[model samples]
Target: MTFSPTTLGTGIAGYNFLLRTRATQQAALANSPQVARDTEHFREKLKDIQTSDQLMEDRAMLRVALGAFGLEDDLDNKAFIKKILDSDLADSKSLANRLADKRYLAFAKAFNFAGESGPQLPDGKSAEDVTRDLAAIRTADDLLGNTSLLRATLKTFDLEGDIGNTFFLKKVLESDPTDPASFARRLADPRYAELAEAFDLSDKVKDRNTVYGFASVFADAAATLETPEDLLEDETLLTEALRVFGLENDVYRPDFLDSVLRSNLNDSTSFANQLEDKRYAALAGVFDFHEMAQAALAEEPFTSTLQSFVTTLNARSEPVTTSNDFFSDIKLMLETYKFFGLPSRSNQAGYVNRILNSDRSDPAAMIHGVTDGRYLALADAFRIEEPNTDRIYPPEFADQVVTNYLDRQFEISIGESDESMRVALSMERDLGKVIGNAKGNDSRWYGVMASNLLREVFETVFQLPDSFGTLDVDRQLKELKHRSESYFGTSALEDFTDPDRMEDLRRRYLMQSNLQSSATSSSASIVLSLLSRG
Candidate 1:
């Protein structure tokens, strides 16, 4: 039944019961009438101790004294003890120490009937019945003050069968205050240890449900795991710990590696193998591994873990079969990899080819690859060329594609794959800008040979893979003109690409490019134009 706060009468009753049951208390009281009066005085003081509200230390002290008195015989005694326990104490530290020292120790010894009196009852065994139990008490000094019972009943009794008697077990540990090492030994006694361990494990499971949360039990185990090596070394315990590492007890699953893999990639080739292994493919076909990778990359703890995962994907060398979902995942992985500055060169080139070669053709995927910006620098660095051909889309068409792609036209790809439409377009656009901006005396000329080669490759794609002429160049030009006007206000396109304004354009482009070297010109057109304008 539920209990309210303690009353003064209840507190006094509880205190008196403690004195009656404790063997030391009973013996001490019986020493004289003065001792009995002292006990009653202590009870009256406790009534004063009971304030308007409950206190933790007070409750604990009351329970310890009550248990010491062996008042478990009466239901009213139980109520008194319960109220004391249920009381909310103001001080926790005082309570922790008090309960540990006073109540807990006394309650524990009460089970053995130390200092109890009277004859055997009709309903329950009396003080004599406690002889065998008292034999179990690991007492150090009597009230008369003499040492006895070093090993006590703990050395002989099988504690497992007496699991219900945890009170005495706790006492045996607490009774010898000076001997912590011996105390630990008794607490870890194999029979008692087994029951305690089981109870603790069950309680932990009830408290924490997730795999991550359940993993905490192992963390606690890791703290004070010293023992008879056998229990600590048990395979079952290790397996439970390993499961938290994502290893579902099988090498085939990617999570089968250490949960540490989420934070450290250099740990094993096994992690790489599972990510790259094609056999145990993702069964939940719609889910993207990239989502998990992205989240990991975004968090510091998971950074290296995602890096290792990406590194593994890069090494796979084969395309994860493309469904709409797989393709989307591949895109996400590429974007995440690039954002983290971990681009895979061979994989990018290869994955692009695979996308181009895929049965399910999509143009938007190409747009995604170019705008990610990671490979734009690479495209300029490598000067990678398209093969021989002569097709050329107008500058405006290329510019519109660049603008749309840059304005977040598509979500990025995440995997380190060799196939993506966006990557191809990015390479093409970056190459085009390289060519369009090329001047005889321009730094853009630095990569002219590579740009020319790339132009040829673009032409080849146009003629053989797809026709550039089929693209609506004129419409694209109009759209570009309109956008430029909208941005620069009506006159933005006026003489914008005019040869007459080439000198002005060159200066503007040079200034905008943030080139360290100044652009100088010997052209009479610029000089004459400047003079005439002046």
Candidate 2:
């Protein structure tokens, strides 16, 4: 017979159930007409299988019939219906009796049954009772055997990553679920403390309230202390003090607490004695005590010398130009030295003293005493002319020397790699103006220094794998133009085209090409020598 839409329910679940029943009936009829007849007869015998006892009997009968026919009875509705249809009358009755006695319906409803239908339990057991049974079934073996369930449980505690970890699994399986102390021991372990915290399963996990209460107690006790000595005798305060510093386990150790309390914070020796303890090593290492002490001792003299240097620079009136803040200029110079990882503070002080003590009329004397490797690099970088004992620089030469030194250092530190060459070129152009402006400027020392720096840049570039033409000339020139304009205004471009400056640049380029040729020859000679020796 064809079923109408009205005969089936409107709900999705009810419709699905009826469809499964129909499918099962069709399968049974296909196996044998007798199986269909038996299913109809059984349905007639039970008007409604609504009760727990009735459902239990039905399930057992179904299992027996399906078993006889070698048909599998799964949790699905179709399988359940098919099992009942294939059951033998005699076997079905006997199996139903056993199932009802054992309360098999409750187990089936809890685990096997599908959909949102409420489980029909026996009169004494409620839904909660079935839940309790399910919870109790979670033995260590049961959990281990069910990987999905075990993984889900671990995920609930934010320990999902630890799932399948043999060591962690072993520890978890070893802990007795029934023993509160066993659970506490696992929770107390720092390794599992985070998991315990995620699950809200540990009483020892301190919350804001616990911290506030501890703080309140400490504040009350500390308010009564007239001196640091008062902390030694109070046992309660001492215990809390230990707990405050995460040394709660040592609260009972009076000797440790007494030693902590007796130690004077003001006395360096007492503080050092406390730091000798392995426990305080981590805390002690947080501070660089040696550096702090050295800085404190050096503070006064360093400040005085810096002030004197600033005063000397400010007093200079010759070579009058803009941007004459010596303090800021000298600070920038010092920072540049630091950036290059050269010249310790002692050497810096010596340099500063030399600059301050040298005759303001001739600053070339300041370069005389610098024989150190670090200072030699600075001299080369700045193109500083070495001092001649008989020759004295002009009065205005001192300002140029100091200005050139600071500018070169500042540019090298701040400029990009290619921009360093651009800066040297810009300096050459600018210093040319200074040389040209001076009366009887026969020395042309400033022009010479700038040309020397430019030559050095060319030498470096020639050593590189790429030629100047192959390099990112557009980007380099753009950056050079921007920096020069920013520092020396737009007029810097005009200065670059000066006849004398152009001639100097041409000469410097030739010198660089010659030097590269010489270097290549020297390298070839070394390689030939090594081959000859071989």
CA error at residue 53 for candidate 1, angstroms: 18
Distance from true location, Cα of 351 in model 2, Å: 32
The residue-by-residue lDDT of candidate 2 on 82-115, one tens digit each, is: 3332333234363322342122222342212231
Poorest 10 consecutive residues of model 1 by lDDT? Answer: 410-419
Judging by lDDT against the true structure, name the best candidate.
Answer: 2
Per-model clash counts, in order, read 39, 1
Taking all chains together, the TM-score of candidate 1 against the true structure is 0.16
Write down the lDDT of every candidate, Cα atoms only. Answer: 0.33, 0.39
- How many Å off is the CA of 111 in candidate 1? 16
Residue 66 lDDT in candidate 1: 43
**Residue 156 lDDT (model 1):** 28
